[model samples]
Target chain A: MDTALSIGSAICLLLGSFLCLTGGIGILRFPDFYTRMHAVSVSETSAAGMILIGLMLQSPDGIVVIKLVMILLMVLFISPASSHALAQSAMRHGLKPWLSTTVPAIKNKHNETASDITSDKGVPPSNL
Target chain B: MIHTLYLSLTLAAFWLLNSGHYSPLILSLGAISIAFVVYLAHKMDVVDHEAQPVHLTLKLPGYYFWLTQQIILANISVVKHIWLGNKTITPTMTTVKSSQKTDMGKVIYANSITLTPGTIAVDLIGDQIIVHSLLSENIEALKAGEMDRRVRQLEH
Candidate 1:
């Protein structure tokens, strides 16, 4: 039983570390702020959840398990709300997203839905 | 009254679990603190169903199970895009309609959208949500209202 528990924990820890690494690389490689935020959410939700579950499994007693569960619940509930707020604030600041060519193509084909929202520049130069 | 009682019970449980002592002095202190908190909550007028959703206790486990599966699938999709390089990148912002009835339901729906890997819910105006996605496929799915239907069922 101990061996099975340890093995499961090891697997979960490894997977969590791998997901965090992927998210880090994504943050560095993605085009702009919104995409980077999305990448970070990958780490926040699944990666953090996997790591916490692994820790919970490795814990020996009920108190430790309860503490781990509390932490997990906080992460699951609070992280998404904060992310949504961040995205909303950014959008409210007039930071338009980089859309695909298809949106512009359709507009050009119709010539009626022509928008002032330009799509040429991939990402803003700097926000700082 | 029920909300206050439930809140106090929950606070007491949390206190007991956090404090490993069961002596008279410590127990009384814990009870006093819990009472003070309940009094404050009652004065603030924040003891409602959404604040203390005892009803969701039974429904949340199943919803969380389904959400976990969605999270895993989303992680896989996002990791693939991250590795495939930026030539395959396409970020789009669009608005989608929601069909939830209550404020809590709409908040849940929007948060679920943000919780998924590629999609972010930017703004919510009535039933419509402004969402930004790393992939068009994610947006297409949101626009289709499959997730909306599931969340509506959960809320109901």
Candidate 2:
């Protein structure tokens, strides 16, 4: 059981590290700032979450698991929020969307429907 | 009715689990602590119709599992781009009008959005939520309204 648990824990940690590494790669490789944000946000949350769960599983005592869970709760609470704030700041600062390679009749595909682009109302959509 | 009690019970269990040991004295102390916290929250008038759980059950595990999968896929996508070694991260921001009515609903929606990779909620103003994305593609995904639809389903 201990060996099985250790194996599980190791797998989780490896996956978590992989997630982080990929997120960084995404941040560096994505064509635009927005794309990078997508990578970082997704990878960070999952990697952290999986690693914690793995650690919790490996713990012999219930107390450690509970404490680890509390930590998980904290991650669930804060990381996304901070990411959201960062994205909002970037947009408010006038970051532009990337142009697509596909040459459709109408450029700025995002602008077709007001609702399709931005929320119901905020800033007008920038042409893609 | 049962759900609220269950939540309270869960909280109590968490407190006990974290505290360790199952002594009667400690159990009573934990109960008192939980009661005090709940009472204070109620006195603050934070408890209301929206405070109720809309989708309280085992299905939450499904959402968590799905979310984790999405995270993995997203991580892979991001990593691939990064390894390509081109400066491709483009940050884009936009406001989304939240369809959720209750405060808890909105909170859940916001939190869920954050949970997803590559998208972050900047600020939720009134009914509109401002979000930033690392990839403009993430914006396109959001425009698909998958997140909104799923989160709304979780709400009553």
Candidate 3:
């Protein structure tokens, strides 16, 4: 049982570290502020969650486990609130999201496929 | 009255968990601080249902479990797109109509949208949230309203 628990904790930690690394790469590679924020959000949510959960699993003390859970809850609640605030403020300041020129074509293709599916199902197309 | 009681309980629990030293002096200090803070909170008029959200305590765990699953899936997709590079990404912006009647519900919905990677809630005005997504399909998924429904369920 101890061995299994240790293995699970290790796996979670490793996965969390890997996700953090990818999120860092994403922050540097992605264009514009909003996409970069997405990268940060990715790291903030799952990576932190995984790491905290791993710690909780490894900790033998009840108080330590509760502390870790509290920290996890705080992160889960705060990260998104901060992200929303950042995005909202940035938007208010008129920072346009970078869009690819090819987006229209892909959007049209998606609409066509969606309409086709709806028509086949005998349902009217909802504004998508 | 119930909100104040819950707030004090939460604060007391938080203090106890953090301070392992069971000395009388430290315990008294913690008690005093907690009381002062709670008193200030009451004066500020923030100790209402919205602030405490005692009603959500029963339902939050299930919502959180579902949200965590969605977050994991979104992480995988966003990470895949990151490795796949720019040409594969289709950044799109769209407005999703939220059916949530309460401000708390709307906040939860917007936060859930932002919590999932590859999608960000850029702006929320009334019931319409302007979302920027890394992929158009993410926006499509938001439009499908599963998260909205879940958040609305939390409200009740």
Task: Tell me, by lDDT, which candidate is best.
Answer: 3
- Tell me the whole-model lDDT of each prediction, alpha carbons only: 0.82, 0.65, 0.83
RMSD of 3: 7.6
DockQ, each predicted model? 0.56, 0.39, 0.35
TM-score on alpha carbons, each prediction: 0.90, 0.70, 0.89
Segments in model 1 whose C-alpha atoms lie over 4 Å from true places: A102-128
RMSD of each: 3.5, 6.0, 7.6
**Descending-TM-score candidate ranking:** 1, 3, 2
Model 1 DockQ (Cα-based)? 0.56
Give lDDT: candidate 1, residue B79.
87
Tens digit of per-residue lDDT, candidate 3, span B108-127: 89888998999998778777
In model 2, where do residues sit more than 4 Å from their true spots? A21-43, A85-128, B1-7, B52-59, B95-98, B101-103
Lowest lDDT sum, 10 consecutive residues, model 3 chain B, at: B86-95
lDDT score, candidate 3, position B148: 90
Top candidate when judged by DockQ against the true structure: 1
